[model samples]
Target: MSGSHVRLEPLTMDHAAGLLEAGADPGIWAWLSSRQPVELGEAEAIVKAALTDPDRRAWAQIDLASGRFAGTTSYYQIVAKHRILSIGHTWIGAGFQRTALNTEAKFLLLRNAFESWGAQRVAWETDARNLRSQRAIERLGALREGLLRAHRIRPDGTSRDTVLYSMTDAEWPGARARLLARLG
Candidate 1:
């Protein structure tokens, strides 16, 4: 998926070096389920795990201007029969945060899920402690459903409360408009 500021490409081991450089800051991995990759080998392992995950279709987010890997995102827990999917495990470099990159990236993913795949519902889950992520999700026009207590274990081995959000097919039009306006 191509956007003005970002392009989504199927992730591969070739992206390991770029991913490691872009995600150099340990802070970006704080709320993620996985630990920060401290070396090239670790980053390659991360990419390998993503590729082998049966339920996930991962992408390498590329910054168009620099033509470098910015981060990664994915559609996981997909249920084709129910037309449902979750978008998460997304992280962009600090340099790209608070910019059009994230908005456009999300717009592309949501568009593909709802329009191309006929997804009935799209979902997101974030660590409740990560207020920034929660706010970002709200900015995408997803409605907060509820909290899932002790939903998953954090990378640091502590239990985390997950804040759940979703957007339905019926609500996509409005969210789509909102995202476009933000991009413009």
Candidate 2:
């Protein structure tokens, strides 16, 4: 999906190289869902796994101005019957962070979920220690539901505390407005 600052294309093998190059920073993978891939091959493996996941719809985040691969994000844990899904496993390269790329990308994703898919809710979760992510989600107008202690095992083998947030269909209108303002 295209946005002012970025375009999200379906995640594919073609994106693997771009992702590996964009995410070369060692610090980028610190709090991400999976461990840092130490090399291009490992990064390719991560892309392969995302591609293989049955429940996930993954996308490659591309910066529009430079046509650079920014990162990856996904709509996963989809329960179509329940009209619920999650937007997570998102990570942008160092150069793209703090830019409008993320805000626009999220706007596109949320719009697709709530409007196109008729989703009732879109959930988001991040490591409790990730203040940046929490602030970003909050800026999107998603309500902080609660924390899920020991929600899952981190790539480093430690149990991770997750901060849960969600934006129901009822909340989407206001969120959409805020996003539009940001994009302007």
Query: Which residue pairs in model 1 clash with each other?
Result: none
> Highest TM-score: which candidate?
1
* Model 2 agreement with the true structure over 1-184: per-residue lDDT tens digits: 8977999999998888888888888788889877777678888899999999998999999999999899999999999999999999899999999999999999999999999999999999999999989999999999999999999888889999999999999999999998999899
Per-prediction count of colliding residue pairs? 0, 0
- TM-score per model over all chains: 0.99, 0.98
Off by over 4 Å in 1: none
Which digits, one per residue and each the tens of the lDDT, describe model 1 over residues 88-113? 99999989888899889999999999
Model 1, CA-based lDDT:
0.95
- Worst 10-residue stretch by lDDT in candidate 1? 150-159
The C-alpha lDDT values of all candidates are 0.95, 0.93
lDDT of 2: 0.93
> How many Å off is the CA of 9 in candidate 2?
0.4
TM-score of 2: 0.98
Q: How many backbone clashes does candidate 2 have?
A: 0
